[model samples]
Target: MGESLSQRLQHPRRSLGDRHRSQAEKFLRLSNQGEGEFSVNIQWAEQNARQALLHDFTHPENWRMLAKIKVLLADDIGIRALLSDLFAVLGRDPEYVSQLEDVSLLDVGSELLNAALQNDHLDSDIWIQSFDASDVDSFVERFLKLDLSDPRCNVLFGRRLERLWDIAGSDVCIHLGKVLLSHRPQNYEMWTNLGRAHERMGDYDQAWLCYDQAQSYAGHLTVRDDFKERMESHFDGNSSVAWSRPEISVRKDFLVTMEKLSTRFSDSVIDTGASNEEVHVDQSGDERRLENMLKNGDFSSAFFLSRRLVTSGEMWAKEYLEASKLALEGKDDVIIP
Candidate 1:
């Protein structure tokens, strides 16, 4: 019985290894299709690399090959995503960490290192050296210029914007915000962040406009109302050029009053988790809150929370995170379910 069980386990392992190697070879062949020039069909190579990772995520060779291809293709976002995944996997195992030391990254440059470096303390390192760069603007610039029909990719770019905001502050992000808005004018989260960035730079007029646009585009109640309140506080009820619209002021006052009243009744208890079905319902409810966080442009919270859900085997959260990743590569139509 022990021998039979061991053989069954080894059989699956052998099959997975075989599939991973086949896919890796396919990736290499396609990646070098036009070795001396740029005529090679790189898309096919990318697809195979993706397949290789799916078969056996722990394979360092596949990670290195894909990283090289992503660099060659100037797919900075793809490289970061690849490295991030590789580190997430390999960082957990000591043997894999040692193997990572021998990998040779290609010419995609230090931007990859910069990304790893910036988030290194928080996550994986994979023995890759950090790049000497002031910022990840080059990668961001490349990402912004690409098409963004995929909603999940839209969020990943939002992560880039978040990083830009953190490293360079609001001035730099405002411009990138404009570029993103030009493509996705209805992204309320982008509008809110743009408004905040403009506010930080003391560009009140632009800030007011962004805030107003955010309120208009907000599909969620919490975000839309928050924008309204921000506009009021910024203008301070001075109905001059800043307060050209009467309705916005009314909304601000009404929401502020409502908030005050809600706080007064905030001590009220809300029952939860009374039964198995209720516990399941609560989980679903928590997932909805997570969805709202993603929609509200809170990528940091969404990402961390998604990580927890992934460990807990929440299929929906996993799907959402995967869609966001696929969106980074511009490979799918991510509707953000």
Candidate 2:
């Protein structure tokens, strides 16, 4: 059986993309030569083009080829959707969005794709091909400059980082994964990838935490349980000692570390507009701040703050923690102040 769409997305093969794109180009040329049935030849071209995209979505050429096919079919809506998907992969740069606002894609789809290719700043595959992976510092410096808020870009970069785990090491994955997750904590696949990186590095406790987060967002997933089973199997024939989750204090310390790492890349600054003196004078300052964070849909920050407060023996923060967890779980009834 062929790989599922999720599997292809999670583990893209560039060689497959190249092969399929070559076939697509061949079929497209044949279709344009007026040799066989035009519709059948074009449909074959479209199928191969689609496969190319599925194999390597980070490739601008693959997107452009598909967009061209869509235009040939006079699929205006498909062209718009394709452009939207391409914009998502590019991190939705404001320049592209603004330029496309009043433009007709049907009239100039190819031109727009050319413009996007020239302006793309978030193509992880391009970065991977252009940058030296062995130079971790340089690579990370370039990576940090990109807008990591888009989950699609994060996932693409995360997959690339996973491929470079041996050279770049798991720490880079953990650091950048935390940074990206701070912006879009709902990315369960990224959480799973981060967990795999940690597990590969023998950081079982941190892996458990990441897998736990993944399961939290996608309860039907068995990543956490699978991790536990793997741990158990690792110790099966070796010794009587069995693996267990880290102690509460240890887990809390891990969360603290993640919280600190996330803050380094987080763009959201909680501006209370209150002076230090006013904050010191107000007894409910932290509570108000927590409420504001929740109201702003900044659940990542809210979770960390509420957890810290609750750990410090502030009982009021317990409610906030509950509310933050509910909100994170996407409960509709959880209302923010």
Candidate 3:
């Protein structure tokens, strides 16, 4: 009986704490190695870290370490999941989570942003306050990569998008604004951002349409009046739609051909960048001359100006030039303001 009991003790089952500690140590060993095999080490570290959490779901240290690993891997979805777990385990103990300064999980529609301003070490505040135009692409890229399915993540991303729009212009604005609208269709701020994006893209008709949608769902009279003022300011008494080109008559065959060609160009734009496309502009001395020619129905001069811009890699101007050429051909079906 003594020998049997001794043999059983040799292969004793480990407690959850002991198993979690062993996995954590293995993760640390792989993570602390020098940089030569960094990717391989990180992969192993992540596996061990995940195993640690599985063995001891209540361990805050395991959750914190896993979140750090996810952040280093640029695994946005993984980071959010770790954060959710951390937030749950550290409930009412945000300070513990906050001390893990490498990553942050902001509370949606809370005073967290204001609180962050007071905490110099807060990662979100540091990023936002130090933003520069040169860093705009990378800044937007980081957020775009995130899986914002969580409402807290969604609200945080929406705020970042609003700031990004002010600097990066229509492309970022339109992309994020549309995403926010899909999740919160009645959000006045989301509609306002979308309308602003459309307005900047030279699509006034679409802009006004978005603004009208904003007014319909607005909770405050001030919000509706603000949208109305914006719409009124855009037209400035022109009674003209931004999308309409010069009136010209063409044969049915020619119009059909143009439509097919235009469709191809539109499809190319849609295919090239499925989610994060940008608007490229190459402003030059000829911009005013091109505008003047187009306004005066001088397709000859406008064609030359647009051609020069397109050759300089201003692809956004290509559509406008194509429409001008169609107009010069005595008929255009491309513009339907």
Candidate 4:
């Protein structure tokens, strides 16, 4: 209880309303600041902004801020103009801000005070609008699936994706990408996308960090090497298997020597930044290997496999149950080489 979970969930208990409105405007500012200009989808701009901002953070207080903003701009030709003004201030301003304190939250208020900056701001010329309400709604429905944890994964989309790295400077997309990496450390796709973005930025070391962090497994040293080898082999070629060249193989005994390796991570190579759940759910075991074992009726092999899992005390894996049952049945396929 280093921080009270309740305090971690700090919401104002007092009402300082515009008679009692409190300074809730501050929360909106920080949320948008964290996101670096909430880019709206012109036609479905209102819907997109509402959901994106709402889903971006899981905190209840953040959602309350979104609800309040929706109430504030519920009317209008559309919230597009007002939203644009908010984003204009949101642009170039977050960069200078330090420590994410509370006053800059007021910058958003400066615009809320102005009614006519609405005309000064323009809709993205490139965003097409549609007359059908459902079309906009449907587009937003798909966007709802977009994982906000990784900005680069989604921002580097369409042709805009290709030109993202070519922009005037680190635009909203890049800024959000960094925030995502720093904040959502447990998200692999977040790390993967950041690595991809770093590749675009030509910071190979940083990019490699992203890749290495994503690629690491957390178990035995020998098995980790085998996993790494398998991962490297995946990059062998666009024309073949790997993308790199070897006049010949490096660990001359790579084949025979590396056979004594564990396929799953233990603890040491485990990257805290990656999700532990992802390691087991989607590691690099070839489907062909599992399928062949089943096809060859390698029941003892499957039994021993399941035995390790059961003894590992992971309780939830049904694979462990099946293995125990197979061992009870005395299958003969397993004879470790």
lDDT of each: 0.47, 0.69, 0.47, 0.33
* Per-residue lDDT over 93-193 for candidate 4, one digit per residue giving the tens place of the 0 to 100 score: 22222323343333343344233223212122232221233444443343333332222222222222223333423444444444333222223344455
Which 10 successive residues of model 1 have the least lDDT summed? 3-12
User: For residues 1-337, what per-residue lDDT tens digits would candidate 2 score against the true structure?
Assistant: 5633333444567899999999989989999999899999999998999888867776778888888888888887777777766766665654464467577677987787778776653465455565465678866786666665444566666666655566676667677777767655656788898888788889999899889878866666899999999999998888888889876666556656554544554444653224322212133887887787788776767776676566546777888888876675452221100
What TM-score number comes out for model 2?
0.58
TM-score of each: 0.34, 0.58, 0.34, 0.23
Worst 10 residues of 2 by lDDT: 272-281
Checking candidate 3 for backbone clashes, the offending pairs are: none
Model 1 has a clash total of 0
Q: What's the number of clashes in each of the models?
A: 0, 0, 0, 21
Which residue pairs does candidate 2 place in steric collision?
Answer: none
Best by TM-score: 2
Question: Could you tell me the lDDT of residue 129 within candidate 4?
Answer: 26
Per-residue alpha-carbon lDDT of candidate 3 for residues 1-337, written as tens digits (9 for 90 to 100): 1322112221222365356556655655666766458777777777766766544433345545565566667675565445434433222233444454564443321133223323322223344676778987775565444433223334345556676666887776676565444332334456666666766676655555556546654434254356556666755676675323212121212222222222221211111112112223336544654565566655534543454356456676686677555554432111100
How displaced is residue 189 in candidate 1, in Å?
Answer: 2.1
Q: Give candidate 4's error at residue 19 in angstroms.
A: 32
